[model samples]
Every structure is written in C-alpha cells, then in structure tokens.
Target: MTCRVVQWATGNIGTHALRAVVRHPDLALAGVYVYAEDKAGQDAGALCGLSPTGVTTTRDVDEIVALGADCVLYMPRLCDLDVVCRLLSSGANVVTTCGEFHHPASMAAEVRDRVVAACAEGGTSVHSTGSSPGFISEALPLVLSSTQRRLDTLTVDEFADLSYRDSPELLFDLMGFGRSSTDLAGRVAHAQAGFGPSLRLVADALGVPLDALRSHGEFATARDTTEIAAGTLRSGTVAAQRITVEGVRADRVLLRFRATWYCTTDLTPAWDVRDTGWQVTVEGDAPLDIAIRFPVPLDTIASVTPGYTANRAVNAVPVVCAAPPGIRTTVDLPQIVAALG
Candidate 1:
C-alpha cells in the first residue's frame, strides 16, 4: 500500500523528508509545503538536491492539505497547534519529527482538546517522534526494561557536534552556542520544551508513575575562538550545553534523559565524544550501557540528524494513516517497519 505523503516545511528535517518520501517504495511524494518564497514552485526532488520529482512545492497550506495526501511528513522546525489542526481538519494523518504533542496526554488541556476536536472533525490521526525524545528516550528505554528485574535509573544521553549544522537559530538562539560562560540563562534554553511529555511517556511505558519530573542544565566553555557552519564561537563562550530531564520516583531518579550537544569536539573531558552517536544507560539488577553510532561518512553526523528524524516520521506514515483519529505517540503506534520492499 503506497501512502501518499506531503512534505511540510522544507527546512532542516523537512528537506530530508522530501527525499525520503520520493525514494521510499511504499510512499509517494504527493506535494510539499514551502515556507520560503524562493522555494515555492520548485520541484520537490530538485529542492532536496535530487532528480526532479513532479510534485511542486507550494507555500499555501490550504492548497497542500487539499491535495488529499494520506499522511503528512510534518518536520517543520517549529510547529503550532493551529497549523496541526489545519492539517488534521483537512483529513490528513500527520507524522511529525518534532513540535506539538509527542504525548497528547501530557499536553495542556485547551491545546489537546482543540487538537482532538480537529481530529474528530476530520477523522485523522497525528503522531510525533524523533531520535532522542521520540525513540531513544521512549522506545529504547522500554526495550531495555524488559530485561530488568528491579529497575533503578534509566538514562538516555545524546551527544552531537553542532558545528555540522548550518542553522543560526539552532546554534545560537535555541542552543546558546556562542553565549558567554556566565550565561546560565542560555544553558536552560531548551530544557522545558518537549522533554516533559517524553518523560511522561517513558514513565508510563515503565509502568512506574513518577513522583516528580525535573529539568537540569550545565555548560562547557570554549577554550578558544572557533568557526562553524552556523557562525563564529568566541573564546570563553558557551560551545556546548548539557540539558537533562529526569522522572523521579520517591526522590530517587528513575528515568534520566540528557543531551550533551556541542559545537566543537574539543570540550573539557569530552563526554561521549567518540564516533558513537548516542548512549543509553540502564542501571538496575542487570545494568546495561550501550552506545549507538551511525557509520556515515566522516564529518556528516550532524548533517545526518535531519535524516534520522525525517526517516522516523516518513516510515511511520503508513502506520499513522492506518491509526484511529486523534493525536497519537510512539507508544500508541506499532513498530515502524521500513518499507524498503
């Protein structure tokens, strides 16, 4: 069953989604939503640096949604409830890499209610997932817990070099990439966004209700000035950030999710600085520590991140299209079988 997929917001992850949609044997690139005026009217494949696909990109959301795609690969940098609702109202099931309701139950009452209303109105479904908070934080932990007799602490630590990315907002604004060392404010910038819902889903999967959930942040200063695809990092500035979210039971940390993202690999004591992509630590009667790395071309790990997120969303299109109406999580969907056949 080849699913008709629309690529939404051709930036960052969306660009990768564009390529994935056209290439997947079980998926077809029905259309695309172009945020930039220059991108509109361009062939979807050409836009993503591939052979020209017949599907042309459009800036009008209504037009793309009206194309009646079976599912939308919603990988925009930032997503909003209204935008998601608009897509759902058009009766297109949505599979997102990030932004809006990784776990709908963890969302605010009004926002969740409206999203549910839209889904009900159009009989569509929505699923949000990504590598870290989506899979590594949710699926990986649940898989490892099956071997645990007495579970203590489960941690998912992600380390990535940000110098591989070209987005200024991601490097500076979202991550505080080049900020001063004393800027604690920059450290906690992304601590509160999507981690809470992720922690909630993780706790739910483990069958352990958390007494509390907490956010923590720390920084690694740059020893010298450095330049990256985003911009320049001044000496003594924030080159790396370690942000964490933990689900605690009775004051003891049960599930801990930490992301150590840096611009340079030369930070102090360089944690998780190897060729490995991510590390998942499970501490219990049977303690386990595993490191995950993608054997991609050298110096392309950061650039491959969007592909990781993009594939997760694209591969879930058939599942999301088959799911019942309303917002769903990775916990709610079945295993994503790559439609390589």
Candidate 2:
C-alpha cells in the first residue's frame, strides 16, 4: 500500500523529509506546501537537492488540503495550531517534528480539545516526534525501564557542541549564546515548555504521574574572547548554558532532562561539555548508563544534523496513518521500523 505523503515547509528539517519522501519505496509525493511565495510553483525535488519530482509546490493551504494526502510531514520551524487543525480536519494525518504535541496531555485543555475535535471530524491522526524529546527522552527511557522491577530515577543528558554551527542568527541572537547575559526566565520557560511534556509522558508511562514539573537555567561566561563558527564570543559573555527540567513525584525528582549547549570550552566555570550526543542514565534495580554519539565531524555537522530529526518523522508516516484518529504520542505508536528498501 503506497501512502500519498505531502511535504510541508521545505526548511532545514523539511528539506530532508522531502528528499526521503521522494525516495521512499512505499510513499508517493502527493503535494507540497511552502510558506515562501518564491518557492510556490517550484519542483519539490529541486528544493531538496534531488532530481525533479514533477510535484509542484504551492503556498496556498487550501490547495494542500484539497490534495487529500494520506499524511503530511509538517516540519515547519514553529508550529501553528490553526494550520495543524486545518490539515487534520481535512482528513490528512500529520507527523511532525514540533515538540509540543509529543504529549497531548501536557497541552492546555482548550488546545487539546480543538485537536481532538479536528481529528474526530476528519477521522485522521496527528503525531509529534523528533530526535530529542521523542527518541531520547520518551522512547529510550521506556525501553530501559523494561529491565527494572524497582525504578528509582531516570536522567537524560543532551550535549551539543555548537562551535562549528554557522547559524549566527540562531546561535547569537535567538539563543543568546554570545550575549552579555543570558535570559534565565526565557530559557527556563522555553525548556519547560519544550521538554517538560516528554518528562510527563515518561512519568505517566511509568504509572507515576508528576506532582509538578520544574525548570531552571544556568550559564557560564567566556574567560577570553573566543571565535566560533557563528561569531566571536567576547570575554564575560555567555559561552555555555545548561537548562534542566525535572518531573517530581511524591516530592522526589523521578525524571530529569538536562541540555548542555556550548560554543567554546574556555569558560569561567569550566563546565563539562562533550561532543554532540545524548547520555541516558537509569538508576534502578537494573542500572544502565548508555551514550549515543554523533561521530560526524563538527565542521560538517550542520549538513548532517537535520536527518537526526527529520528521519524519525519520515519513518513514522505509515504508523501515524495507520493509527486511530487522535493525537498520537511515542507511547501510542509501535516501534518505528525504517522503510529503507
């Protein structure tokens, strides 16, 4: 059964997803939705560095809805609930890299209700997944917990060495990497919103619903002016940052997620920073310490990082399309088997 897939938003992650959809053996390119007017009427394949796919891209949302694609790979930078609801109400399943929908229970009641209504109306499913919260935080923890009869604590540590990342706007301006002072409130809120849901999902799966989710941010300043791929980090500027989100149960931290991102090793506090990868530590009856590393060179990491996020969403199309209509989480779906043939 060949599923018709729509490639939505040809950005970084979207570009990778578009290429994969075109090459997938069990999927056919149905339509493409682009936000930029310049991309409208362009060949989908040309946008993703592949041979022309004959499917022209359109900027109109109605045109995409009318295509009736079996699934839409919604990989936009920021999630728009209206657009997502529109797609779902039009009978197209959606598998997205957006972090918010990973756990629908974590969403506001009104927001969740709206999506539920949309799914009911069109008889379709919507799933949110990606490498970080999807794989490391939710899926991996659940697998490790299977070995334990007595579970104590599970921690997920994510490390990103952004020394070679060349996105000035993302690193310097948006993330405040090279800024004089870090915005603790903003970072904490963002971390809580982005990763708190994954922690809640894991806690719920373990049958220990959290009493509350707490988040905090810490930063280290540069000891000396350091030049990175993005730009120069002046002395006393924020050179390293760590955001931690924890799920508490019975007044104890049962699940924890920590993200450590750094552009240079030369910092006032001298924080421990590793190569781009993830570390999962499970402390229980069956203790396990696992490390997943990205061996790609730092210089070329920008070109390779998108697949980490995009591929999972691409592999999930079939599972999402086959799922019962609702907001599907990693727990709701079966193990995503990559259709690489």
Output the number of the lDDT-best candidate.
2
User: What is the C-alpha lDDT profile of model 2 across 61-149, one tens digit per residue?
Assistant: 88999999999999888999999999999999999898869888889999999999999998999998988868888888999999999
TM-score for each candidate, following the candidate numbering: 0.89, 0.96
Looking at model 1, which ten-residue stretch has the lowest summed lDDT? 181-190
TM-score of 1: 0.89
CA lDDT of each prediction against the hidden true structure: 0.80, 0.91
Strongest candidate by TM-score = 2
Error of 2 at 99 (Å): 2.3
Q: Which stretches of candidate 1 lie over 4 Å from their true place?
A: 163-180, 186-189, 222-239, 263-276
- Candidate 1, residues 136-219, lDDT tens digits: the string is 877778779889989989888877666767889877886567887535554454554667778778788767888888887888
Residue 92 of model 1 has an lDDT of 88
Whole-model lDDT, candidate 2? 0.91
Q: What is the lDDT of residue 333 in candidate 1?
A: 82
For candidate 1, what is the total of clashing residue pairs? 0
